[model samples]
Target: MNTLSKKNDLIDEFDIIAKFFTPLAKDAPGTFGLLEDAAILPTIDSHQEWVVTVESIVCNVHFLPNDPFELIARKALRVTLSDLAAMGAKPYGYTLTIALNRDLSDSCYLLEKVSHGLTIDQAEFGIHLIGGDSVSTDGPITLAITAFGITNKAKALRRSAAMPGQDLWISGTIGDGALGLQVAKGILSKQYSDLAGRYRLPQPRISLGCRLSEIAAAAIDVSDGLILDASHIANQSKCRLVIDGGALPISESVSRIIADHSEMFELILTGGDDYELLFTAEPEAIQKIKQAGYELDIPITRIGRVDSGEGVDVLDHNGIKLNLLIEPGWTHF
Candidate 1:
């Protein structure tokens, strides 16, 4: 398990981490052995603990090479912030690493736009740029962001805390990001500006995450699509997750796409980039969860149930298990 070996049809990212980086991370007390979404540092002055997470995005791979610099910058920062939200930590600050192609004529202008985008998100998320690094590169532009947050809770919510019999809930809608990517690439015929926006600027559920820390048993952000992310919870918690396909909440735009191209349903289920929160809670906390969503004006939907088993099951409205049509979500290498 600690070595990276070819598994079935694909390479497992966790196996790579466990082999290459887990040893190094284990040397640091607060690194969580590189197993958790974010690392938690000890409480400072007996008050709050620090939670840190980092993510990187490469040009053309993560975003179009010609995408607006502002959106690119915003997406880079917000995605990391979403990690903080998942741990129920409040934003503290972030550092950015940028690799730029100095030969491009508009490189300077693109950097300026990127900075502007970061500025806007800093204000919106109540965080500031603390530090970063820059370098010249001949390849596509790359961005790496490390964000930190502080939480007063004794321990941050964890993916491994889910239990059998807990109800699985998700915040807001899903599949918009996948649909947005389709619109951006011109793969889908229907063009909706909102879908494109979802692809570019994901709304991180920071507020809801904070509230769920008290009510939820386990939590994770839906960055890599619903099924894949849910499976993360299942794997970590050692339980089976049964999801009702009909209960999946999607935007009107996504619904229209589904109606036109039924095959795209797999994309909705497996496509990545939806930065929503997928969490689990006890049945008794349902009312409190609903109240929190209602008070915050964020929609929360119960789409699945946790059971005594392993992996996940996607069931139709008629209760028949559905076959997977694609790999679950996005993966690097």
Candidate 2:
């Protein structure tokens, strides 16, 4: 693949596409390696097997401008891929649209670096670049990716499927992404680089999600903050969720930091962008779910349970619900 341009600046639209993007579409059927007007998805068992989702991210909003090039590119794709994971889907391919900021002085370098990152992640995630568009923009560097995945026909998971009395669980630890952002802004020491890594290169829980279709009644990836996402499950399912504040799965580093900076606990609850999976399943499936988590090596923690109410309740050691978030009608009153 022609990964770079000899010139220091982007030459033209076609030049950019030929050098950077076409190789990404390589070997995916019907894509013509992005050398066509449109593309067709690889044929599946049925239309019901297809799961499609799209998400757009802007520099300095979803990600910082100075973050590594590959990270930014991977972040854009992983964000969209997580949507499919939430639905218990394996990746098919994706089309990306990149709007390059005119203000960038090193546009060619940026494109080269971003494309290199995309190339690496495409291979890692087993996805092909089907097709996409690139254009100039007066605003910040922005990317919109439309991702496709495949799942068992009619068996995709949904946020609105949780029922009262089901157990609530999450994959991986939380707060790392939020803490990572703080590290980026220099609010924390470099000892917390792991947290920052979580922010930059989020590992989508595809294995956990794929296993969940048979185990979970409802599922959603934790992109927005944990409490916010859990509220989505409750609101959509028209049930209440009660979580124990002390039971949230946290890493050793996070536990140490929280012990010293008690007030920083809020970041764990409200700091969004952790791409872990939050799901609900029947109480009887606890052992089965734990087995799946063990087999997958992704720790699964049961933080709460679905209840017959309208919102979310996070109970403290005193058994009283805490008003941690000000989201009216969503948090327990």
Q: What TM-score fits each model?
A: 0.86, 0.94
Q: Report the Cα lDDT for residue 6, model 1.
A: 30
Q: Rate the local accuracy (lDDT) of all candidates.
A: 0.81, 0.85
Per-residue accuracy of model 1 over 1-333 as CA lDDT, tens digit each: 122123222235565445333533343455555666555544565667888999998988889876788999999999999999999998777767777764666554665677678778877987765545556666778999998888875758899999989999999899999999888888875458788889889998888888988899889998887888989999999999999999999999999889988989999888978999999999999999999999999999999999999998999999999996579888877
Q: Model 1 segments beyond 4 Å from truth? A: 1-45
Q: 15 in model 1: Cα distance from truth in Å? A: 43
Provide the lDDT at 284 for model 1.
Answer: 97
Q: Candidate 2, residues 1-333: lDDT per residue as tens digits?
A: 122232335676666777888888777889875656799865666555788999988887888978988789999999999999999999999988888765666977888888899988888889988888877667788989999988997679999999988999999999889888888878998888988889999999887888998889999998878888988999999999898888999987789889999887877887878899999999999999999988999899999899998878888888898876654221222
Q: How does candidate 1 fare on TM-score?
A: 0.86
> In model 2, which regions exceed 4 Å deviation?
1-8, 327-333
Among these predicted structures, which one has the highest TM-score? 2
Give the CA lDDT, 0 to 100, for residue 287 in model 1.
Answer: 100
